[model samples]
Target chain A: MSTVVVLAPIIVANWPVITAVVGAAVGSLGFAVVRGEETSQQRGETTTREEIEIDNSEILTSDTGFEEEIVVQREGVRAIFSRDARGVLRVCMEGRGTSHAELRRWGQELIDRVTQQYAYHRIVTELKARNMTIVDEQVEEDHTVKIRVRSW
Target chain B: MAKEELEIEISPSGKVTARTLGVKGPRCLELADLLARIVGREESRTLTHEYYETERQVTDQVDLYGHR
Candidate 1:
């Protein structure tokens, strides 16, 4: 390594990526998205279908001034997405039915995925703005990204 | 050929690590600095054997060109 550096990621929340990750996380845990109309219609229906649901509108709110919270539910895990006063997006996993360690793992995984996507886009955009040619880029299996660029 | 190259790795946790290739001498740090600014704030930096080796090559080239 000619030079090695460590840095704290500057969080510029990419709302699209966050929304996608929320869908992914919920899907991976065997939850289905419930649209507002469907949720209301199914209130009295006896259904055997598994329905771990989240409101799509709440996840895609355009308002960025105040805090927004979206809750995604699984069988026993509740994933909460909220923005703090400082504009920091947070993912919290909580439920009394599951192990605390398991919830923490899920929460951390969501955070890592969001941060990785945000950094990837930010770095690529900045590199282009600086007129550097991106030689190659790849996302590793560990969810890390490697980019090689050439600059005169 | 553009003899300056930068490789950056961003960890899942949002930490960034960058290295310079094909750049010699103090120029290595200069390239790194540019990349660091683009990526994020630098937490720590370590210069490798390649860095020192490139520095020596730059010095040799300067001496050769200067004398001629």
Candidate 2:
């Protein structure tokens, strides 16, 4: 008798096991559920613009409410998140630069730059063994010095 | 399942660093190579216990003393 060896595709293994597997995946990634299910920081503040766009100009809180903002008032680098009218998560980085595009570009960049300073980014740094640039120049924004990246 | 995680950061100065985790073997090097190709700066890397290790650490290259 002969035995056969096979290399199967590594999937979530599909449902009715899907829900359980998703839960496991979420838990592994250090996430908890509030409403009905799984994981991580989503950049949305489900509120009116008037509520989020206050004079302070801060971004809306994360879905899990585990959110943060770092602003260098003296050096002019600011990162903020908020939920727009459409209820999408938005991360906007503000800083001073020569042109509008330049400021926006730098704003997006500074977010990634400052992030690596934190503990989480530290793991990412150790894992990657190289720098990760979150903001690419492909997206264009108004010359407001605010680089806004959105997520669903 | 490819649970790969990557991170890169630059300080107030132009100093930059990169890291990857959960990616077994030299596959992580692909990510490092991509960043080096783009950032164009001579960056240094540190291998951690998350995925791999190095007999020697690549330090002393960055201006570590000037951490402001």
Candidate 3:
């Protein structure tokens, strides 16, 4: 062993990349995407919904031509991820009969998953770019991903 | 020369912990720094005993052999 370092992931990416990671995160958490066209209908049906923003996360988008939002639902709870005016990614949760605390927890979980996926993607891409080889990779029971890489 | 190895673990909450295996001296920090830049800011770092041992070995080798 030589050195050990701990890092806190910072997500700074374009729209498409962020969207793809968001999709993967949602899927991994058992959330199904609520299509753009059907989100309005879904929103209308949830009468007692609540919205909460996830803390300490922002996805920067270069394009300003259009606003894009990704909505996903799991067990009748909906999570909406969109970039605010400041280019800060915002996640809002909506669900009927769900307490505010529950919504917040779900929103945080989604953000956590997104951050993990983003970090994984960045690490793998960088390693490949540097001509490094991943010798082993695995996901632990706690959902933590371990990767071993070698370079001559 | 032995191959340099890096062991990286990304927790469920996305915090990353990386360790350099078989990499000696200051070169280990270089590898860790590269990863820090790729992932994000470094929260904390620990240099194991192995880190200093290599530097001491190099100094001893220099003392015995003189400048090449």
Candidate 4:
């Protein structure tokens, strides 16, 4: 080994790419994507809602004048992901019977998964663009992803 | 042709640690920079002993060739 580097991933992507990562994250966490109208209807029944803002994340879009949001539901808990006016990503979790703590935990989990998926996607895409081939890839018990790539 | 290898480990929290293997001198940093751009800002960087060893070998080779 020659050089080692540690990086903290900052999520910056277009709306469609952000949606894709959010979809992958929610799917892995056993959450199903719900239509915006369906989520709006479900919100009427929710009693408690907690919002968590993810730091170091931004949604880059040419048309930032419009708002976009994605909602996912699992086990009666709903998470709505959206970008604030400043483009920072936020998730609001709500459920009728779920405690605020539970909602917060679920929101945290979702954001963590989103960040991981975004980083993995960016790394793989950039590496492939540079003509590098992934020789091995594995996920550890702790959910850390290890990838070995080679360039000749 | 020589093969350059990079081992990247992304933690669950989305922090990335990348180590370049079998790459000599400053060339290893190029790979690390590429990853930094893809992921985010680099938190820290460390050059292993092998980096210096390779630099020494290259300098020695240059000296030997110049002496000839």
Candidate 5:
């Protein structure tokens, strides 16, 4: 990827889920974010959209306002943290039946529980992480990924 | 006897790679800003060579608050 690394998609456990069909159509929910971005979606149809599921939702349930359609079958996967081209900092998971060793075991248990829960602060002790690899495995298709990071 | 090297890589499809060793430049964005606040959201960012030898950029881009 070239540029576009300021994103968020962390939907823990799973909220009420469709809570009354997206809270009564979430007032014709419009995409707060647009332009080629979506993960974990398997309830597809109505036109064209593969997947993209990032929760902690804003309570918007598509009526085709912001082009909404996010579902990971049963929300078994959700993760997004990117920046490649050697810049490092990677955490990417594609959804839609979420598989690929269970999204690489939930992206390696969310980076070892977010690096020991933020290892005593100080911006994570200045970028110190090492241990992980499985860059390719496309269980047929729709579940893609590529990972690697290193420094000093 | 040298120790203080970090390298984290988690791929298979869910991506995340953090590599830091002996620390560098103002702690390299304090180590890539605490792993960009733990995969909450960060699509892109670049700075190495110990993140240009960061003197200070403490990492502050909050405003995600409740994560809506």
Candidate 6:
């Protein structure tokens, strides 16, 4: 490679885009999405639970639509993905019987998957807009994408 | 007749590297800029011998120590 670069992901997307990517990432990582379920005790019972939620709408403004929360569970790890008022997606990972490092690693993997999917779509669209023809595309064993294009 | 080719590698971690083939001089920079804009920010670039090859020269010696 003549020029090599490292890209730090800049999370900028609306709720729909974020939700699509989050679903894809969740599937790729073997996590099953569970719909809304009660996290508190019923019938006026006083039971304390340490359930962690991933809602960051408290700091959002009025422009961004009402926040939607998604919960995915796998093994002892739970990941909550949501979008804030400013249209930024955030993922919060909590583990019930796992170590802190394991939780962080899982969170990183989710982020990487989402970023890769997003970047692939964005790059293809932008390059096509610049009038470049895609000659070939390959996905490596590690899931990285290599694309060959011709400008003229 | 040879055609200009740009090989773009997007890592799983979202890094991008573009290698230009059959393009020389300032045109290489243009290709790199195009790829960078499509990918993300420009981190660093290393100029190859082909990068130094001019449109008016016929040199074939490989120079491998150019970086910026």
Give interface RMSD for all predictions.
2.0, 16.6, 0.7, 0.8, 12.6, 2.3
Candidate numbers, best DockQ first, in rank order: 3, 4, 1, 6, 5, 2
lDDT of 3 at A19: 78
Tens digit of lDDT per residue, candidate 3, span A70-89? 88888877788887877777
Error of 2 at B47 (Å): 3.0
Model 4 regions more than 4 Å off? A40-43, A63-67, B61-68
Off by over 4 Å in 6: A1-7, A32-68, A84-88, B55-68
Q: What tens digits encode model 6's per-residue C-alpha lDDT throughout A1-152?
A: 33434444344555656666667667768887777653223334443223222222122333456447677777756677765555456676766566667777788777677677766776778878888789999988888789888877
Model 1 Cα lDDT, one tens digit per residue, B1-68? 64678888888776777878876667778776765665556788888887798668778999999999
Q: Give the root-mean-square deviation of each candidate in angstroms.
A: 7.3, 20.6, 2.4, 2.3, 18.5, 7.1
Q: Name the TM-score of chain A in model 2.
A: 0.25
* TM-score (2 decimals) of chain A in model 4: 0.90
* The candidate that achieves the highest DockQ relative to the unseen native structure: 3
TM-score of candidate 6 chain B vs. the reference: 0.71
Better of 2 and 5 by lDDT: 5
Q: Arrange candidates by TM-score, highest first: which order?
A: 4, 3, 6, 1, 2, 5
Candidate 1 local lDDT, A49-149, one digit each (tens): 22222211123345545325556666645566665545457665655555667767766665665555556666778878888889998878876789998
What's the TM-score of every candidate structure?
Answer: 0.65, 0.25, 0.90, 0.91, 0.23, 0.71
Q: Which regions of candidate 1 fall more than 4 Å away from where they truly are?
A: A13-78, A94-96, B52-68
Those runs of model 3 whose alpha carbons end farther than 4 Å from true positions after fitting are A40-43, A46-56, A64-67, B61-68
Clashing pairs in 4: none
- Model 5: per-residue Cα lDDT over B1-68, one tens digit each: 32334444333223445555556465555545656675545566555554443334433223344354
Q: Who is ahead in TM-score, 4 or 5?
A: 4
Standalone chain B TM-score for every prediction: 0.64, 0.58, 0.84, 0.80, 0.28, 0.71
Chain A: TM-score in each candidate?
A: 0.58, 0.25, 0.87, 0.90, 0.21, 0.68
